[model samples]
Target: MVCCSLENNDVGWFSRRQSAYQCTTPITASQSCGGLLARIRPTILQIPPIHAPSFMALRRDTLVEAVEFPIHLESIERYFTMTDRRECAFCASEITEINDSKEHVIPNSIGGRKKVRGFICITCNSSFGQSWDAKLAEQLNWFSLAVGIEREQGSCPAKIVHTVDGTELRLRADGTMTRKEPFFQKTESDGKVNIRMLASTKREAQQRLKGIKKEHPGFDLEGELKNLERTAFKVNSALQHRLELGGSEAGRSVVKTAIAQCVRLGIAAHRCEIGIYTLKTPTDDRGFALFYIRDVVIDRPQTDLFHLVSIRGDSEKGTLLAYVEYFGAMRVMVNLSSKFEGDSFISVYAFNPQSREELNLSVNWDIPATELHAAFNGFGLDANNFYLACRNATAIAYHMQKMRERHHVHREELSAVLSQLGIPPGGIPEPKDRDQFNSLMEEKLGSLSEFIKKIPPMPDD
Candidate 1:
């Protein structure tokens, strides 16, 4: 009689002896070992047949291979070692040193500085970065440029916009605009041709004049170039900006961030069934992601532009959810999974998009899993809540815009103050004059604070 003591909860593995095989009663299938067996079926099939007492005998008549107990245990141990290797949460590819890459829980492109390891392989990271993440970043670049969002990798991206008057503008990161192409308007007044040239740079203006030189051989291109005056042009008219928020590509990107947040919280990507499914399939307007439904208040300062992500798991209700707000402008909720079997947890991350400064944030959503499902399907009063949230977000964004304008004005005022202190505008004082400069700055800098009080109220206010 070979006595094999293989009693365990998840998997049963027999101990090895040098001389003979000792076999005890096999672990019962009622202890969840059956599920373990199913998972390791491929490994089990690779074992060579040995004429001995069955180690996994569910019945007394079931006689199977267990001739070499030590060899069998080694094989099971090797299989488990391979199975325990880290894999990408999205693609399930093994994460080796060659393939391991830091994944930002929020995308670095959109001012997301938080990063985690062992959650994704480099290949999947690159693929998502090019597809969904790229699109989402492009969609939010306008707001990023406006708010001067701090990024871990690079500066905010510039975007091309077409004004209502058919002027193509390249919006810069510092809230400045330039024409996409060198443009000149020709107007005739009182028998004289007045050419108005608007070029992005002096080089461009010179190039434009060179082209005009070909039109008239006698024209003094060099002379007119020397007389070129530089002036600032501001668009006073209303410029329409249309921001289309959600679709397949952008939706997948949002879900990716949500999944990364879950992975950061020690939840495996495979457990996020809905999130993975959404990433795999093509999504439409009614996808797994939706505009945030539950009532939420923007308690942060109105002038602060923030990017926020919140993840929560309800073990009793078997629901896992993620909430994301981009630049306090667009908000989305992702139903990560409905079969979550983890302990209840809530995690939040918030940061000023401009400063990349982390904020201590608390987020709570008492809404049930059923309501979340219904919210995704556009049921009940979710539409009302969504509208209200959007309105509030817009109000905050508008306030931020006004504040940004005031900030620019304050810079000019500071320059004037510097000139009054016998220092050239934008010039640093000499080392010898530093003592006097410091005293003057302290005396006059308080006036700069007055600009904040003059900022206009929000549009809704």
Candidate 2:
């Protein structure tokens, strides 16, 4: 039997020979040996294919192919060729027809060519246009290309190292040195002993050593650490500081102030009212003075009608009189008396003749003595005789009550009128409360009712 051995040229020949020659056989000079030699020679002589081409060759080939190759122009050249064409990049529909504008994949202003290979239709472009930028688009394309290259060939073991400035250093993929200053620098009075660390890479480590020699003019080589703790600490500290202070409360306070000032200036009136009074509850021995304000009203205009200014007196003596006024030439004076601690009573009569008589005429129904007392206690009604203080401590309260009742009935009617249309309800909390409910309201609706109201409806064509 004839025997032959073949080995890979790329791998060390010795290692392949050792692994291949486990069994030994005698070689004979004969016709069979010639046949075996012929078969083995062909197998050993054939050159292995080169998987990775040199950079220079690749660049040369790309340029030559790009120039020599005949590019098949797409059928929709009219849409893609013109940089300023107002047609949709995707569908080739006229921008005016679609009521939109053509968008560039790479924005023209940023050194990006006007004509882009990838063009999206107006609808698709508009959706992307809302939030995308050229930098992001470029980064996405670069990442995709990198992934493709990595998949074609397994990852290469190439590394770079460098000693950047005392603060930070980046070793690029190709042998290059990048130095970044420390965000914060700490120093001692005793001469500046600059501290720097080097990344472990062949290209950068050699370059960094040379740089250190150049910088120091003549410095001895220092031992390297397996872990760069000082450099890592500095970097981590810088990152922490950036994360903490960047766009933090200090940064957002200015925005908050601007919004608050804008709301205060833009809104027509101060939609708020304050009431101060003394209450004599049965549980308490003496009446205590209290201060309270009505809930904030966003839309309603403030009216001074039957608004109480102040209350002063003892609850037991019934000497408490509330000084109050109404919007139009109306004033009231009320005397409150409590027979029992729990049960208080008040007699509401106009201070003047015309007002009292008008109020008496207006209130035809027999007023409950306790209710009148509670009304005076809760809201100063006798401040103006003609106007008996009505529901809640709001002038709009009467209108609001009527509106609320009508709201239920008008809900269906208004709903029918507003079907498919987004008219927000009239009631929304004032701007002061908006911050509290911003997340809730923003989740349910695109914006708060108050904010939506500020934006005028689109004009009918």
Candidate 3:
């Protein structure tokens, strides 16, 4: 266990047991939390008093991920007295301010918000993003969109889905779909030209018309615009989506995330020798990632759709293992290193991908080191557990779909109320009539209690 308390010095200092470690030196107050935290040792550093939430959390929980806390400091001694943590984990090059960058344990595109700095240099970080993280994001973006996950960076990539009748559609991040291509038909009979064009949107139709006008120079653009009609069709056909996981690219990414979590848990990245080697050398072998369902079960809180990561180190067994799960459907166990000779440690992080909110939870699996290795090597695989996980994922998706439908219905009802009040679709009432508008809206929309009862409360934090 680690414990730290603040000192009354000009610069904040923390003492761990018998030893004292200077976590921060006097620096400019204007520096951001990320920039300030990056200058410290990569090891676990207690958050300052100012960040009460994180500081209090740290006192009660030892396994929580480190939170950023800004402190006033000048450019004094930045290196930790224990070890120089500025060395890159992959390349072992000295990390300078110019080369340092924050690396997310989970890819940001897939709704990961936690990040660590000074663990890997910018070069290795960029390379991993382009290769490992990119492939993983591509493989998981469909589920991300379906879950309506909140991303730390750009929005999740849209997926190309197909209907049962073989119609191609672009599935957007918000659970909406549009035709991949515009539909156009032209007919000329009895010296009269007839043209029919249909598209998912008016803009799409107009763009297609531009191309058509080139072929038919005598076409009337104004008449066509006046005749344009907006159509909404309900698609009853089921959607078909394909997901393939555990490729070399995605395998590397899983391993990378495991190693990153280990680093965040106070294990130096250099100590993760096997993980570094596996990431650096690319191969077609998918054994690095194995579907894992805990043989020893413990009841965990129900989380609809969450991303989970856990790392365990057993010095006696001389093994370090990590587990990564995306959307609670695909679970993977990775053997990080077999030469681990550090103290036994375990850390878990579980959060709802949709809200990007961390959950107060823990995960436990009682598989022995030998059995885990055997499983990783393709021995004694459990097909039943994998199937169960997939089924559960499908159920969660269906639940989310139903919730979205309810919200859509609510929006339509609200729109109807606005129309009744002589308000435009997106316009609000004037300031003078605001009170009346509120009263009318409440009277028409019914009680808020009914809506709350219809939508279940989220899982406990």
Q: What is the C-alpha lDDT of each candidate?
A: 0.56, 0.24, 0.56
Clashing pairs in 1: 2-23, 3-22, 3-23, 3-24, 4-22, 4-23, 4-24
Q: Tens digit of lDDT per residue, candidate 3, span 1-461?
A: 01111111111111111222322222111111211111111122233333222211222222222322121011111011125466787789988888976788888878888887667889888876458788888877767776777676567776776654565776556554456765567789999777766575556767776777788889877666544542223344434445555667777888878877776766677666667777777763432655543522245444477788877666566666777888765677776666666567667788887777897666665664344444454432344444335434644653464365345435655664666567889888889778877886676355322433333233232
lDDT of 3 at 151: 73
Error of 3 at 144 (Å): 0.8
- Per-residue alpha-carbon lDDT of candidate 2 for residues 1-461, written as tens digits (9 for 90 to 100): 01111111000001010112211211111111111221112012222332323222334334334432121111100001124444433345555644543332223221122222222345745553323332222222211121111211232122211111223343222212133322222244577555443333333444555666676664554432112111111121110000011011221121111111212222100110010011112222112111111111122223312211222233343233332222212222223222112112222222111111123212121223333333223322222121111111212222222233222323323332232133355545567655644554343232122222222121111
Worst 10 residues of 3 by lDDT: 1-10
The better-scoring model by TM-score among 1 and 3 is 3
Which residue segments of model 1 deviate by more than 4 Å? 1-84, 185-196, 201-236, 283-287, 297-301, 368-370, 380-388, 398-455, 458-461
Best by lDDT, which number? 3
The digit string of per-residue lDDT tens for model 1 on 351-412 reads: 88667789886676665434444436443223333333443454455345446644654564
Going through the candidates in the order shown, the clash numbers are 7, 6, 6
